[model samples]
Target: MFKGLRETIRAYQERDPAARSGVEIFLLYPGVHATIYHKFAHFLYRHRLFFLARFVSQWSRFWTGIEIHPGATIGRRFVIDHGMGVVIGETAEIGDDVLLYQGVTLGGSGKEKGKRHPTIGNNVMIGSGARVLGSFKVGDNSRIAAGAVVVAEMPPNSTAVGVPAQIVKVAGERVNYTKELDQIHTPDPVSLEIQKLTECTRRLEKAMRELEEKRHEDI
Candidate 1:
């Protein structure tokens, strides 16, 4: 348990440049505190102490503002930065080295019996305000852009952006250009579509001008 706590602290330090020291993280980081609470709650849940486990999870939510179901399976080095309003539902499975920013949700789309929530793969980075709904697998080394709404499964090493999330980059190495773990400058799908339309309009105008010049030459 101490080893896991130590590793969690280390992960926070490594991933977040704003973290000054281990003591600071232990004292001030609500994400870490939520993870610690979930560990014990998960243990109780496994032992069939459902009420107790839920109580702990609810208390953690009240304190941290991060709602993580006790039944959710979380692997090592899972980090949630600025973790307020982050929600991980029951049956959600999160792999190691996954990073999630604030306002991210791993939730079910509708009422389901089992395996309702999404499964997050290793080395995945989910940006702020992203909603990964339904029982889908977000592949390893993938990045979900800020405010993206992903309802389908994502392939490995892909970058998804926009509402209903479209893949922009795939089969490439993960990128970490800044310590803030931001995606503010990532390619915008809406802008790209506008640019394509602008180019098409320019070509049509040029073609009409050429046709007019040919008619004058014929005259």
Candidate 2:
């Protein structure tokens, strides 16, 4: 139990440098508390104490605002920064060195029985408010952009962004350039419309200039 507590604390330090103080991490951070509580509840779940385990998980969720089912399999060094509104499903499997931001979901889209949740590979970063649904696989070293809704499998070393989540870049290393984590710059619809209008105006001006030049030459 002491070892588990130590490991949980170490996970916090590794993920967030702002967790410099134990008191702050213990009292202020809901993710940290949620993980610690999940450990005990998870143990009970594995031991077939289903009723008690679920009860504790519900209590933790009520207090922490993070919903991580005790049955979910989480690897070592799993980190959730600003983990409010994060939800991990019952059958979800998360790998090592995974980074998740607030409002991330590893959930299902159906009423299936076995393996209904997504399988997240190692060294992956899922951005805030991203929903990775269904029983798909998010390959290793992949990045799921913020507010992206991914309902299918994402290939390894790819960066997915936009609504319905398109893989625009096949980033070999899956680099996270943005400190905000896993967020990619997808052309916003409103911004794209503005750009198109600006380009049309420029083209019209150029056409008018060419027409004036031809008239002057005729004179």
Candidate 3:
């Protein structure tokens, strides 16, 4: 447990430039506190102490503003940056080295019986305000852009952006998205579509002008 705590603190230091020291993170970081509470709660939950587990989780939520269900499975080095308003549902399973920003939700789409929440793969980065709903698998090394609403499976090494999130980059050279949070500079699919349409319209107009000139010459 001490090893795990050390690893978590190290991860925070590496990922967050603002993080000063391990002692400060242990003492002051809400995310670290939430994670510590979750470990204890999860242990109780696995031992069938459901009520106690829930109580602990609720207390953690009250104090940290991050609600993580005790039944949820979280792997090592899972960092939640600015963790306020982050929600991890009961059935959600998060893999190792995953990073989630503030206001991210791993929630269910409907009133399902089992496996309702999303399964996040290793090394995934979910940006702030992203909603990954339903029982989908967000693959390894994938990046979900800020404010994206993903309802489907994202392939490995991909980047998902926009509302009803679209896979913009897939299976390419790996980019360390967890270290970067520049949401404004990510690819805009809407702008690309508009540019394509404008180019097509220009081509059509040029073709029509040439046809008109040819007809006049024949006359």
* Worst window of 10 by summed lDDT in candidate 1: 171-180
The residue-by-residue lDDT of candidate 2 on 100-213, one tens digit each, is 889999999989999999999988889899999999899887888899899989888777777787775564555542343426564354566689999999999999999999
Off by over 4 Å in 1: 177-180
Ranking by TM-score: 3, 1, 2
In terms of TM-score, how similar is model 1 to the real structure? 0.92
Q: lDDT per residue, candidate 1, 1-219, as tens digits?
A: 998889888988988889999999999999999999999999999999999999999999999999999999999987889999999998999998888889999999999889999999988899999999999999888889999999999998787899988887654666552354666767787888999999999999999999999999999
The predictions' CA RMSDs to the true structure, in order, are: 1.8, 4.1, 1.5
Whichever of 1 and 2 has more TM-score, that candidate is 1
Clashing pairs in 1: none
Candidate 3 lDDT score at position 80: 92
Which tens-of-lDDT digit does each residue in 1-219 have in candidate 3?
999999999999988889999999999888999999999999999999999999999999999999999999999998999899999999999999999999999999999889999999998999899999999899998899899999999988888899888887754667586467676577778888999999999999999999999999999
TM-score of each candidate? 0.92, 0.78, 0.94
The total of clashing pairs for model 1 equals 0
RMSD of 1: 1.8
Clashing pairs in 3: none
